[model samples]
Target chain A: MTTATIIQSLASGLLMGLLYGLVAVGLALIFGLMDVTNFAHGEFLMLAMYMTFFLFAFFAIDPLLAAPLVGAAMFVFGAVAYLLVVRFAMRAKANIGMVQIFTTFGLAILMRGLAQYFFTPDYRSINVSWLGGKTISLGGVFLPVPQLVGALVSLAAFGALYFFIKKTDFGRALEATREDAGAVALVGIDKNKVFALGWGLGGALVGLAGAVMAMFFYIYPDVGASFALIAYVTVALGGFGSVFGAFAGGIIVGLVEASTALILPPSLKSVGIYAVYLLVVFIRPRGLFGSI
Target chain B: MDDAHSKRRLRDLIVAAVLTCIAALVPLFVKDVYVQNIMVLTLMYAALSQAWNILGGYCGQISLGHALYFGLGAYTTVLLFTKFGVLPWFGMLGGGLISAVIAMALGYPTFRLRGHYFVIATIVIAEIGFLLFHNWDWAGAALGIDIPVRGDSWAKFQFTRSKLPYYYFALVFCCVAWLVTWWLENSKWGYWWRAVKDNPEAAESLGVVVFNSKMGAAAVSAFLTAIGGAFYAMFVSYIDPESVMTFQFSLLMALPAVLGGIGTLWGPVLGAVILIPLTELTRSFIGGSGRGVDLILYGTVIVVISLARPEGLIGLFAKRRKEVAR
Candidate 1:
């Protein structure tokens, strides 16, 4: 590819990478603490996207404005989900995979159906004034304002998260639970509360990411699946339950996908990601930043 | 004791045969193409789900991407027939072989990741295949590859105008798959598969090569799915990424196994019998024009079943029968 094309791809990749990290952080956190793979995690993001869509359409509010509302709403949603579905599931079976598999898949279908019934399967989007009105000219490269804003917001969120996890009491409780649930319980911290908090936080982060994503992408029932698959690939590549690893992994995947789409046909980019995923699995079963 | 059990099984088999014969003749008496098509589709699903059961049911692999093998079979036979002018009767076997190879390839990395990881890998891998097939120039891309309909030619696998042949063809496939399940259940390999499913560590300690046994089961399972795919392609007389390789199609194939009783021979059959007819009814009633009532119902049913009847309809029956015997 030409130098200009490569530069364009890399710039876009950098922007997309930040959002990927934001989205993936939640997946990593939930998996790290709970050992439960939430198959319906993507649907949480889908719901957030729809919420953002409605907020924008009704009040002329930007997706950024809708972010906190959606995040808070989903945090409660996550807690309720844990209490109602996951609690009962935990009591009944030890084969976490079997219980989670059907439950999450069913939940996904339920959510998709609900969205389709209520929203009518139509494509929804929001236009932000700060996002796309003007472009910044850096040397000879053209960068859109919205993407630059998205990148900055995503980076700030990650920074805030990193600081909170390392500095705060709740974060310490979370980390303790992640390291050893039984030991955390022995230390007088309620493990179930920790789990509920982790799930809530995970859901909130993904919801925020979803709202931001809606600024850049269209909202639809299947949009979550598209991004979620990439997040999954990134999670596997970076490390299953490592937050920092997920951040790095998301960037790496974003670059790989961007570069591949630029050089080859866009349709063939998925094939490249799949190849990388297979290669990583073959070489490092525990992933690049796997705690294992 | 063994001879008496064998005699009892023989008697059951005879009764089942009589029932099957009567069921098979329903289409002959009823001339509605819609009903006939539904019956044919149900039989195909029954066959497909039964094939999936060899791995997901008996071995407890819980693959969500079994459609990969099925798509491979469909595409391979279609390609072979169009390009080489080979008769589909023999060409379909080639499709089966291609599917087996792909299964073995994916099985190496994926089968290592048991339970949820394995399920995710299967889905990701299948999506990869879907993307490739949708974009590849050799495969005709999004436009879809079409198989020329050689009317009334048995060699070409194109029937003149009747859906009856397809109905019978799917019926035979379902029967064969059921027979294969029967053979496995009574065979040493079947016992080994069950051993692996119940306790892999114990089975390994007892000298079962867990990996090889799983691989063998996966290969056979993939091969059978491919055979079903070949028939699927011919029956529809078309092959495309949307129809054959979609994630939705994969879920449809697996739902039967889940709805029936995952590991049992009759589970997939019973699941297909119930689900296909119900799905068809939904399609006719609520799936018309602009209403999404069908999906609404479908999703609700799935949620209810997963929470309330995780063991499926066949499991419920088996449990009842056992309670009665006790």
Candidate 2:
């Protein structure tokens, strides 16, 4: 293989990795704060993608401009979801983990059903978006314009997220709540509020990813199913609960996926990622940036 | 055994016997092929769920990637028979053994990880298998293996003329699964499993009992699940990665146990009884539109049931029994 070819794939892999990180960070944040794995997270992405598609179709808003609007809408959706469904799941006295898994899973199925009922199971995409069908040359390597923009937006979001979590009062509150849910009540902090906000933040992050993905990817009911597995693998790979871990995990996953694509058939590329996940977990158990 | 436990066991056995007798007579009264199909499905699912309950319910290992084992069973039977002309009776046993070994092999790395990590690992492993099978040209790749119908004989385990044989086989499979669970419930391994499920750390302090019990459960759970897969392959007469080894099959097996009762012997059967027919009816009636109304109903039922009764529907029965005793 030529070095340029390797670098070309790696370059695109880096951009895709950033987006993957953004897709995964919300899930990581949710798990980090509360030990719940939202199995419906992929469905959330699907909804956001559809939201982008509709916004563009109806109002002609470019995906780039519609990103924040989609994120804000998803924030409300996420918070309400937590309040309506996940809150009850958390209160379960028995089989707490399974309850969470299945409930979110059911929610995923419901969302898919609803999406299919509404969207008619057709694959839709933003054909005329501002960044759609464009490419840029970076250091003699080509990358899609949408993906480049997505990588930049993702980096900015991560920076803002870091600042928000480390510097902001709400972030510290989120941290405190996760550290000790019982103790936070002693300090007059409402546990539910933090969790709700956390869910919102997580949702918004993935919402941003969905919008970016919609520019280049198809919008459909089951679109989230495949990416959902990858997101879970990313979150778990990055050590389950660490937000930074998810970021790191996404890059690793993207590069692994890209490299695998180079070596194996396109269909077998995901096998490389799955294989790597098994290998990593077998050795490290917690993941790369996960707390030991 | 304690009088109450033994008495409860005896009552369970009697109830099972009566139920089996009733179920055996079902084929006589129900002649419609569609209803017969549903019954076969219900029994097969009950057996599959019961097997899942052993590891997932009793041992408390929530594996969402059981499709790998199911696929393995289906593939093993189909491959051995189609390629080598081996009888399915032998293929079923071979599939069971392969699944049991694979379960242990997988459990080795995965069992040490706790909660979601373990769950995701199982999912990833199964997905990898699915991908491989999809690309495996020798095994018919994505198109999958079509078992050529030979003569209608018990040896081949294929009967085109009658659904009766499949129905009976499924019924016996269901009974054996129930009986196995019942027998294991009182065994030493059962005690260890319950203990390990309740508190793995404390159980682990007893020197490998936790690990050992989990391994045991996974093997048995996997073996029976594989047997179900083999039956399904023969019954359907077609095997594909999408049909057998996808993530959906794993979820299907776990659902009956989860809804009816995860750890209980009767949970899978009861859950399958109510669920399989509802699923079939919904799919046939409303799902014909391909609009996914059935999915909406299914998702709603699962969420409501899991949220409302985390211990499963079996708890309601147990609660009523307790009240009556009082």
TM-score of chain B of each: 0.95, 0.98
**Candidate 1 per-residue lDDT over residues A155-198, each given as its tens digit:** 88788889989999999999999888889999899988888888
Residue runs of model 2 more than 4 Å from their true location after superposition: none
- Lowest-sum lDDT 10-residue window in model 2 chain B: B203-212
**CA RMSD of all predictions:** 2.6, 1.0
Q: What are the clash counts of all predictions, listed in order?
A: 0, 0
What DockQ was computed for model 1?
0.43
- Mark the regions of model 1 whose C-alpha exceeds 4 Å error after superposition: A94-96, A138-140, A179-192, B1-19, B289-291
Q: Please give each candidate's TM-score.
A: 0.93, 0.99
* TM-score of chain A in every predicted structure: 0.95, 0.99
Residue-by-residue lDDT tens digits, candidate 2, B1-326: 88998999999999999999999998999999999999999999999999999999889999999999899999999999999999999999999999999999889889988888888999999999999999999999999999999979999999999899999999999999999999999999898999898899888887647877899999999999999999999999999999999999999999999999899989999999989999999999999999989889888998999999998999999999999999
Extract clashing residue pairs from model 1. none
